[model samples]
Target: MDTGVAIFPTHDAIAPADVARLAEQRGHESLFFPEHTHIPASRATPWPGGRPLPRRYAHTFDLFVAVTAAVTATTRLRVGSGVCLVIQRDPIITAKEVASVDVLSGGRFEFGVGAGWNREEMANHGTDPRVRMAIMRERVEAMKAIWTSEEASYAGSHVSFDRIWSWPKPAQRPHPPVLVGGDGPGVLDRVLAFGDAWIPNHAPAGILERAKELRARADRAVGLIVMGVPADPRVLEAYAAAGFARAVHWLPSAQRGPVERAFDAFEAAVAEFTGE
Candidate 1:
């Protein structure tokens, strides 16, 4: 499987430009930075990973700005938002940002998006957590329209607009690839409906089987991108054998020393797995 890296990109972490430069220099294929506009202190919603939430979640830089810095620092390394919280964002502006980055990076932008989990966070953005999936779908559909048409418009329950002109259409033809992120019930339906690719956090059991089933049931060929991959050759080999298109390893938010150490280890694992 092709190997990429994902980072939280906090203020205290290594600069995104440096991280991207190092990733490309080490032969990594891509760099993804995740987003969280702001983490509410209400503590109404528990952390997705359970227990104390990481400090980086609250301190992460704007995903677009971080990704722009990263992509600007490297020519070959693809940079993207690991998963933008589309349910909380305006689709029109998001489409413009996606197209801008795609154009600026020579079509090296991948749009990974999710509905998100934090109920309070969604509420803060004026989105209802219960209906977030529907909202996310509408927003994604709207963005697609903006990216592909001369005078774009969308009519949906959550998102609607009249014919509006949007320029700088994406460099990647119709649009950048939309990689939907999640592994919850009904997620496969979402992936088949709008996503060009599926990104599921790597799970220990039944994931490869699930991937196979998804491929079997899909109407057209779909891409599988496994995220949160550990630096393990055997696991990566299993992913490649299961026909996964790519695997993204997490780079912890830290200073350059720890970040590079992790990169070295991950690169070694990748080289071993690929027999390079």
Candidate 2:
């Protein structure tokens, strides 16, 4: 399996250009940055990690801007939204951003998208949390239409646009690979419906089973990339054995020294696992 790294893009974290150069120089396949528009001070939605929400969640750089920085700093390394909250963005503007990045990056971009988990945050964007999944799916579909059609248009409950002209279509023929993020009960349905791949933040064993199940349900082989992975040879071995395509190690959002130290460890672990 190929190895990649993900980080929270925060104001005080290591600059994204540096992160991209580090990944490219180290021979990592990709770098991903997660997004959060804003974290409501008060909330009813509990963090999935079960601890107090991390400081990085409340202080993130704009997702596309960070991604653009990373991609521009390196020619070989692919950059992505660890999970761009589709439920919170306008499809038209987002489509333009995606296409612009892909065109400028020579197609070195992966579009990893999710509906997101923060209730108050989504609400702040005028998204109803309950129906956010449908909104996300429609937004993705709308973006795809924008990318692939000459006169793009979409009609859906959440997003609708009549034939409009958009320019600088993605460098990638059909656009960047849309990797669906999240592993909820109906996640596979969404993946088959609109995504090019699946990125699940799960343990290796759980991922193996889910990958098998997803492939069994689909007509063609479904791609799998496990995210939020630890720096461990054993975990990577499990993923590789299961024929998963990639393993993304999570790096804490921090200054250059500390974050690069963590990257060294993850790089070592991947080398060890692959016997390279």
Candidate 3:
């Protein structure tokens, strides 16, 4: 499996530009940044990673800005949002951002998207957590329209526009690949609906079985990218055997020394898988 890294790019972390340079220098295929406009202090929605939410979640730099910095700092390394919260963002603005980055980076952009888990955080953006899935679908559909059409238009329950002209159409024809991110019961349905690939967090059991099932269900070849995967050759070999395209290892939000140390360990894990 191709290897990549994802990080929560906070103020205290290694700069995204440096991270990108290092990742590219180390011959990693991609780098991704997670997003959260601002974490609500309400503490209403439990963090998916469980309690004592990491400070990085709240301190992360703007996803697009971090993405842009990373892309600008590397020529071959693909960079993307680990998963942008489409439910909390404006589709038109997001489409423009996506296209601009893809254009500027010579099409080395992966668009990973999802409906996030923080209820209070979503609500802060005027999103109802209950209907976020529907909202995410419509926004993604709208973005796709903007990227592909001369005069784009979309009419949906959550996103609507008419004959809007958008420029600098992405370098990648038909737009950048959308990697759908989630592991809910309905995630595969979402992937089939609008995504070119599926990105599920690494889970110990039944994931390869699920990947096989997803392949069986797809009429087209659908990519599988496992996120938050550990630095384990056995697990990565299993993923490769199951036809997963990539495995993304996470880096802690920290300064250069800690970040590079963690990254080197991940690289070693990947080297074993690649037999390099």
Query: Candidate 2 has which clashing residue pairs, if any?
Result: none
Per-candidate TM-score against the hidden true structure: 0.98, 0.97, 0.98
lDDT score at residue 60, model 1, on the 0-100 scale? 95
For every candidate, C-alpha RMSD to the true structure in Å = 0.9, 1.1, 0.9
Expressed as tens digits, the lDDT of each residue in 1-276 for candidate 3 is: 688999999998899999999999988899999899998888887788877888888898999999999999999999988899999999999999999999999999999999989898899899989999999999999999999999999999888889999988999989999999988899889999999999989999878888888988999979999999898888899998999988899998899999899998888888887788
- Candidate 3 regions off by >4 Å? none
lDDT (Cα, tens digit) per residue for candidate 2, span 133-201:
899999999999999999998999989989899988999989899999998889999999888899989
Please say which candidate is ahead in lDDT: 1 or 2.
1
How are the candidates ranked when ordered by TM-score, highest leading? 1, 3, 2
- Estimate, for each residue in 1-276, the C-alpha lDDT of model 1 and write its tens digit: 678999999999999999999999988888898889999998789887988988889999999999889888999998887899999999999999999999999999999999888898999999999899999999999999999999998999999999999888999988999999988888889999999999988899978888888898899989999998999999999999999988999999999999999998888888899888
Whole-model Cα lDDT of every candidate shown, in order: 0.92, 0.90, 0.91
Task: Give residue 265's lDDT in candidate 3 (0 to 100).
Answer: 88
Worst 10 residues of 1 by lDDT: 205-214
Error at 58, model 3, angstroms: 0.5
TM-score of 2: 0.97
Per-candidate clashes come to 0, 0, 0
